[model samples]
Target: MDEETTEEIMYMTVLGCELAKPNPLRPGVNRSPSYFETLKQCCHLPIMQKEGFYRFLQLYNDSQVVVVDPESSADSIQLTKRVMYLELFKDLQVLCTQPDNVATRELGQRVAAELDVTYGEQVGVQYRKYNKTSDKTRLRFVTEGMLLQLIGDNPTMAGYSCLVLDFYEPTSNVDRLLPLLKKAIGLRCDIQVVILSTKYFEKFALYFDVPHGLTIGGTSFPVGVQHVTKVVADYCETACHTVNQIHQNESPGDILVFLATDIHVDRVVAKLRGAIPDMETFPLYGKLSKAEKAKALRSGDKSRCVITTNFAESSITVEGIVYVVGFNSIGTFNFLDPAKEEVYLRGIKDVNAMNLIDEVGIITPAGKVAATLPIDLTWYNAFNEAIKLGCLSELIDIAALASVKNPIFLRPHKTQHAADSPHGQFTAPLSDHMTELNTLHAYLRTKRNMSTQELATWCNETFLSSEALEEALVLQEDLIEWCKARLGVSEISVLTPDDKDYDVKIRKAITKGFFLHAAIRDDSDQPDQYRTLKEGSHVWIHPNSALGGGDWEWVVYHKIEPTGFQYMDRCTVIEPMWLLENDYFYPLPLTKDYGGKFWLKPLRAIIDAIDSSVPHRIGG
Candidate 1:
């Protein structure tokens, strides 16, 4: 037998410090604020950011489609402010792809403060459970989902002259949005789109039919980079020791420590506080309330160490940051289960990897591949699957019910062909997640008759995200009201925990969306492994799931994580009879019972036979 081996090539760049240059602009000159000018005045840009700023300004002024790859959060924020200051567009809507509520709010408030206009009066922030935009508003920051809802309401996107996609992450929403944007650009000549990304710049330009693109490169103050030759045992301890070393040896300046999660941040904050009692230490993460985040961002007289998650890296800008300590937790993109976006971290070897200068240092991985990587084909199929599973159908129905003007592009269309390539299969169905959320919210609000305070308390006690729960409750209310007004339906039916058949009803409702994602327990495996009904893919229940320890014969999963062994997320136990009840859509005609080993065979055959070209009913 012969085996094949591949060679590993590593690319690394160590930045060295450079002298600062004096400001070139004359005082009080009558000059318009270009992206380049505004950013330079605010803060120092590394070599790459300055080059990207120049190229972006050139392409934007020419009205040529441009996509910018920003190296830091400061770069994007400064560029956005510069554009708003220019006042070239009538209305600018900035879409945020990440769920960093604090960062998004900070961006809006900062821009509003500089312009001397009140927040929510001239500057708007819109996301789940929060909407502040009005007719008087000129600049708005919104989540990508909110923008989708906006497009559904007004297909032409009337009155919006510029759309700025703040970050570039591979998401199904972005894939669904580009075509709609392309159509909108075609319909109106005044509309323009600015994409700010750290990756995938070229693919975006190619998709939008832009021939030329820009890469940021110029001379600026270099960052002192250091690499560890040996691996350390514990990252938190290593980070604390590094911070102590920097505080003692380095100059008087703020330090930034990057950890992976809130728990890690808390641990590091506690250790650093005890280690250096004189130095102020603060923790920052997405889950922190607005007040907490503000405190972390606030600059104090005491030399401080800001410990935070990776959210701070790309979405936030902390002032007076001269030293940085981070782990090698870089995301390696995988096509099959792209939603598992987080990567694990390792220690920074045995040495104290700290920059001993005034400039912030980065201990990044070896380096990134520079060539433009091809967009995976799975993204397109995943979007199509979302539409087929009625994820977008409800949004369209709501738009039509609320009297949206021509909700075009994505109608309630079903799959044209049944048997897609195995590689194209979606690990998570969007519709299933939606149904699960709706069911949970109804149980909490409608059946339990819980007040807002009670729901908050319940969420806290259950270790669930209150923000997510609140957003779901808001969506439920809007959905019910829309149905009542348009279809004259007084009330919609929902099952709660108090109901007699609550488990059966909720399980069936959620399982219906996962008709293609059903799995049966394998007798050969002890507890964790199960085989998918359609593809027989071996999977395990995610360790954090409530059903992980249960001996359920059948289950329906909403998502999968491909970590050597596939792990199911957001899983629920369901009866096999429930799938059989909906035989028309999910047939189980062939079954074998031999020596207590039941066989549910060839679900793909039935799935292929079903004619999905015709639009199906979305909800009861």
Candidate 2:
């Protein structure tokens, strides 16, 4: 017998830092906890000492560990990325990635130009794929998600020795990556992982079974704080009260009020616009286009009021923002359990439940795959369903758009009559989803002209973001190609509402993938209110929605972000049977007992299937 030769794996040794995982079951469901309520529950994952980071660098030479700097600001991250690049550019390979792709691109390009490297020679930005350089490229800055995709294909994280993660989120990014990095370290010990986090290093240390990891210090800015004597629990109400107080009585300075959802931000903007017609108010959220977001960040106005969600928390800095009315609450992950038919209603306090898992099993291989990559179980399942439905061509694009901070549609303030005027042409009274889908279809039709200038003009005239439309189309193509290669499918048809079976195809796909987000209007007289199928919470269609009247009985939404209420957006009309047949909520009772819509036969088919599956008992 010949002796077998195999690869020897050296595991990365861990250091001491302890952070405890919050129990998924423990977060109080006492009527959606406020921002402060949730934040107070978090443990400050402590590092043993300040000098630990320097010690790790000395011993391992090439080690990847979570970088925790308690005092570091957002500016400190960019400084660290640049300082490290300058120090290590000569000898070692380096890659830096941030949570936001837009920020990543901005940094990558800035670094490229400053270094005088032929833009892509040393740095590159994707979705601007044509500008990327050859393999010799040493320093690469991208979104953490973009790099995670690369690492999935190449487990050894080829061609890069030092990897710096830009920013970390507790439930979504940091928690998901820990297990995979541990596995990767087990395979290749040479890789160095640099984590730039305010906290959560303890979880990293414990999960990897290493001693507490290193902690480095960074400078912090001093700021004055003033709290109102009154207590307001509703985020939107608090925002309005705070803005009103500041706009009316405060001194000259910019006001940055952080609300929870884009819709809420828009609402706050609307109220402020009415209250102070002379003040410059800007709504900043991920849904805004690059150009639109720049409007909020512009410096000419000395005392602008920027109403925003958490998007502005760390990423954007408006110099004159002297008053920061920050909300600690975050709608970070919109999660639903496919197995339980439960919508976490805007946000999940139970971070552990965000990942897809069976009740009994720990981590499936699929879970592990999701753990490594940045996408959620909803997207992971959607791609799986898309493959099964042979609609991977378009579903992947929608999933990609859905996964990002930047939602495809821009919610222009009501005061922008011009923007709102063009939207009426695209609005489908019963379905905001159809409205957006139609807009995208119309935009796609314009592509036949093959002129970027023509599309730009159309986008501007039509109140669409030219940059957003371009990004979505480009992302769609990339996604389809990747899916085809992965699934080994020769071709997958992209479904559109124009096709004969398009409505059914898309709705069925959404139902299969995101049934947890489904809701039905109560049979009574409340028109604007809807009861989610899983959680049974009464939510209203966002006033900003085309279908704010809430006439539809059964609808599916792209997202349900919570602030004062679970506000639905990107909703579409659907047959009630879709919910009745969803496996996650099988044998579910309908809103109606014996009679449903004229289209539905009391949901008769579902009852029959359930009855047929069980054997009749001869005697009780």
TM-score per candidate, chains pooled:
0.59, 0.72
Residue lDDT tens for model 1, 175-245? 66777878878888766677776666777777788776655444244578776567977778888988999
Candidate 2, poorest ten consecutive residues by summed lDDT: 4-13
Largest lDDT belongs to which candidate?
2
The local distance difference test score of each candidate is 0.54, 0.58
How many Å off is the CA of 109 in candidate 1? 2.7
Top TM-score hit: 2
